[model samples]
Target: MVASPPARFSVPAVTQPRINEANRKSVGPLSMPPRLLLGPGPSNAHPAVLQALSLRQVGHLDPAFLAMMTEVQELLRYAWQTDNRITIPVSGTGSAAMEATIANVIEPGEVMLVGSMGYFGNRLEDMADRYRADVRTIKKPWGEVFSLEELRSALEEHRPKVMALVHAETSTGACQPLEGVGDLCREYNCLLIADTVTSLGGVPLFVDEWGIDLAYSCSQKGLSCPPGASPFTMSDRAFEKLSQRPGKVPNWYLDMSLVGKYWGAERTYHHTAPINMNYAIREALRLIAEEGLENRWQRHQANAELLWEGLEDLGLVLHVQKQYRLPTLTTVRVPAGVDAKAVTSQLLNDYNIEIGNGLGELGGKVWRIGLMGFNSRPENVILLLAALDRVLAAAGYRK
Candidate 1:
């Protein structure tokens, strides 16, 4: 019995790794589908951009990384058509860039005027309030754009220190005109902040020419890069205002003064930059440059026209007026009898095609189809139209 007990007590050696050492565990291979990305954003990245992300990992401050950063700045400058030295990629998405611009420009109690024409404008007003600024907004119905006269009136009445406007409202698919708004801001001695998240690379953006003191965008929408990086530019005057902030910027992570030092020639370290995301953005920007800004803009415009023509031919109506429609994002009015959600679901489940539903007030009533960067191709346009036509027809809705 004692011998048997001894034999039973011979325990097996512990072979599993300790819980604290789980970092040594092997990871499974990643698998992703080959579905077409034609949503409001996160359009398929160019092959080159994907390849860039596959490159061997490097330190954030690696000499090669720094060089790439310089090139990125230059490429962003080309995309934004700005000579401002403060142009750089933020460490987060388009929203981060928006927050950075607002945080750096507006201080507590500062008067900020915004156009409440779409979702992004609502976001801007929210951000201004979060920053403790006195927010004033000019309301317009969703899917409508602000006129120059309306903006001028707001500037005159509010006398805000800064005015924020969205160049392309993704929610409503309306492109707000910046024609005289910048000059109006200048006339009123106020800074002009423009949100170009849905406009950059897909449309023409002349920061200096437009008198935009600050502008920001994301790489995924029109640059064809995977999300996670935001390209933002600030003018010399805006930088001057940031330098004079009486108190520290509200968010240390987004403080442009410190971020600029890291991204600037000093190459200082404020945080560990997302190296792979930067590589993705650099390559995306490079592709945009290779395509030529004017050519890329034209491509988007042509694709948009094709989509609109096809959709209208199929008897669908566009939400925004033709004159104010955004090139990258199109808002389609949901037919009276069709369920917007059901149509989108069928398109995804049956056809494997992904599009966007409208946001805010336009939700459930409109469908957003984005013809952006790499997704702005004839083939995609045709496929989307064909799929949409089938789905709507099956649902007893025309077009």
Candidate 2:
């Protein structure tokens, strides 16, 4: 073979595949309906926040980007009213941050007690199950919240390593009061996790004061940003538990011991952070800082009350009781003969409004209307009320 010079052969020309005209469909520039999102999430982002989202990109590790990241962290700390050293945003939706808490804090066989009052509580149980936790749930009907006594009884009965509660239940529009729940967990030697996904910026939340060992939220709902990046924080107590874990975190992407370095002083590489989402959230949080928390909370409350009054004026029944109702989301009971889906559909199609049909056990029974972040304005409340009155009259509902 060597003597024959390997019998030199000529290669045939290769034709790279081009765009197949048969399979390729012509597409035009992007266009979307200007939908006013008044549903159980993804409320319309503030115009300024959207502008930040569309701003130019930067390398994930650029020094300017790193500085911006620090600003983002400080702003987030203000938003959550926490000084947790490891506060950061996960590079996914709110649910990803939800799982991050379970993944980092739980070992395979640990007992985890969840307060399952609404759909998201069930979600917590499901994620805990996937992590191989021995899950226990203390239940209540949708549109209702567990009392401090109920939680104390559950903690005494389950004696779990971790206890999780939803600070704001999105599905049922109920805000679970957490003022003393954290102390109860401490008495039982259990870590506390709070789901602030629907509460964080819009409602009053005190992570450290309430002793929330771990907490998570979404940017889309209360932060007035898009849905990609989510807020997550852990107290020293939770972090200490994580540090003593017998094994590596079960979910690698969400392992905070590794992910924290990137957000902390070490500045190590984790995954590429969501630069644009960080920018968007920083701007949104900045707006919050400028407006002040008390003012924002008042704004959201005033607007929600406005909506509730208008709904009641229309003879629509509120789902949750007044004291437990969430300021960000409201559940309205469907009139006996009205089709819930039809009402929601009319709101979306005719009025350019988008309120949610119910979820889980509430489907076809209640309508979820959101007044969160930037969307929580008196003008929006008036618009939605006017639209709903018209839509309901057309739907053949007596009231």
Candidate 3:
């Protein structure tokens, strides 16, 4: 059929309101300020990872991309020290991965016990509640972690289908000891879910050995990649729970049963994967493999210790006890009569360094400093301390 003379416009096409140019401006090319990210997350992406991010993309299902996908999975298994076959990066942030775990395992009205040790634990409770899980919580002060005995008592009383704990409580800089907590869950015949957002690559995490059934983490923080594309995994037990679930997962985008096919042997397309993010994460995980987990963990620990010592020497108090402190993140008590945000601002505006103020109940009470992945280094630690010393002094903090 011959096309009718090009469709006629209402008035004359040229006279019609030209696509609104009001919102368009001659903006300069994107340029963000140089920032030394020493905050709780989005810690400076490793230079190598950033380089990978700039690499050309491949179709999500292409052989080249699929091969890289497998490599990423293997490296993630190494980083988390788990052999869970369903392990893969979710296509969103840490929060999405966090929700994905809850959405899949806890059928509506099933009890979920959340050990609310800090900010993220509360987040887990919220996500579980939204998923219609019967969310129960046991609380600790912001900077303290739950003892294994406390966890046992909570589990015994709640008898939940799942128990969620933060492996590293970012807001408080407290590392929750998972050694016996997992065993406690197993005793109660409950699946253990762990939030490893701040712990995965920097802290000592043994998912398989620890008896954790489900876990999730971010691309930032310890992984040293940009945010987006979070790591998620489920033990066979957790996957079985998902397989036997009564209905489709409540939230479709994060439902791993469908998402898993794309990452699993089926290679079924669920969504267009974030191609460059996969590249970036591969490079970040590659760095972990090259440096070796032991060496990387040691480097993080050493730098954290250096920072702790330097801060102590400068008369700033660390919020968490040394034994329980996270190598990746630290919470420093705000000095008396000192403005927390001001100190943070001075660090960023004057020194080109960024540190976070606390979140939730800890807000304005502590400063969150991070030594994560590529940003965890002796030089960065020393530079931060020196800058902090000056900033504190300028803020009228006395030694």
Candidate 4:
């Protein structure tokens, strides 16, 4: 009544939840069961690469990291067998590099001729279309490589600005023979972009000799490294086209003009690069260098031959012709009455082996077996053949 002093308020003490071990969620440390990767990609990374990946992380722009980046570029050139100054690893997986090659060099409305041999070739056509290019395709049945004459005819007829092809079709296990096609591209004044995703380290790819204007490959397939930091190289002709584009590159992150500066002397920042992946790839390339490319290619070929012979013994027919078949990836026609997916599942679940089933049109018709990178070994071939034999036999498969 007499204007009493304002009472001070205080926060009431509230009891917190009790910390009990019984109430806490139980989670264990990371541990994955051992697996033999015989699929199209990500054949178990080499021990050296795994160790490198676990090494200390560094800033993308760190001096040591930059030096390593330069080394990685040089090593990639060796792996790709090119002297292209614009060679570098794209920030994402193989598809990112594929997109970069298309988004930068192929301007909207420009005619692009694609050789559709298999699933990957179709992918190239799709990427080019996304760039708004006038895409024209010369398709061969899946598992068949395009002949040089066919390529020449398409190039002459369409006279497209770019001719894209997949060096190794993972879906069909066919290897496109570059051969005189590069000269054909030169004659037609067309740029050649090769998707070497399945062939980069395991197959013979002479970019300069073959006159490939641009190429992209994944790290996981034949590089014996985890997926990410894909290899991308562009020749002077391709770079010139990229530079002369009237409009800005449709993909900001994959724009080679800006990405090149980051990998070049300018060392500009474009994005937060996958530093550990670069380290892993560098070590993988180092392993490649230690084992010469010819030796590595021969190892893949030899192991593939073993697998082929084993499959033959099992009475399984190969999908691709022997001449054009990719040594890194083998597609086996699923025998009549035998489930392809079931075979792969049994191999993974029972044998701890992982093989791939077909993609797109070939799904359930074939099984894609990859003898790539660290997984390309005589013992692996033997294990896969034995495991496959068991699985197919149990599935009631017969010659």
TM-score of 3: 0.95
Q: In angstroms, how far off is 182's CA in candidate 1?
A: 1.4
Q: What local lDDT score does residue 7 receive in model 3, on the 0 to 100 scale? A: 52
Estimate candidate 1's alpha-carbon lDDT, on a 0 to 1 scale: 0.91
Q: How accurate is candidate 3 locally (lDDT)?
A: 0.92
Q: Tell how far residue 363 is off in model 4, in angstroms.
A: 0.6
Model 1 CA lDDT for position 309 = 97
The TM-score values for the models, in the order shown, are 0.93, 0.95, 0.95, 0.94
Note the Cα lDDT for every prediction shown: 0.91, 0.93, 0.92, 0.92
Please identify which of the two predictions, 2 or 4, would achieve the higher TM-score against the true structure: 2
* lDDT (Cα) of model 4: 0.92
Candidate 2 residue pairs that clash: none
Q: Write the per-residue lDDT of candidate 2 for residues 213-328, one digit (tens) a residue.
A: 99999999988999999999999999999999988998999999999999999899999988899999899989999999999999999999999999999999999999999999
* Separate clash counts for every candidate: 0, 0, 0, 0
Residue runs of model 2 more than 4 Å from their true location after superposition: 1-25
- In terms of TM-score, how similar is model 2 to the real structure? 0.95
lDDT of 4 at 193: 93
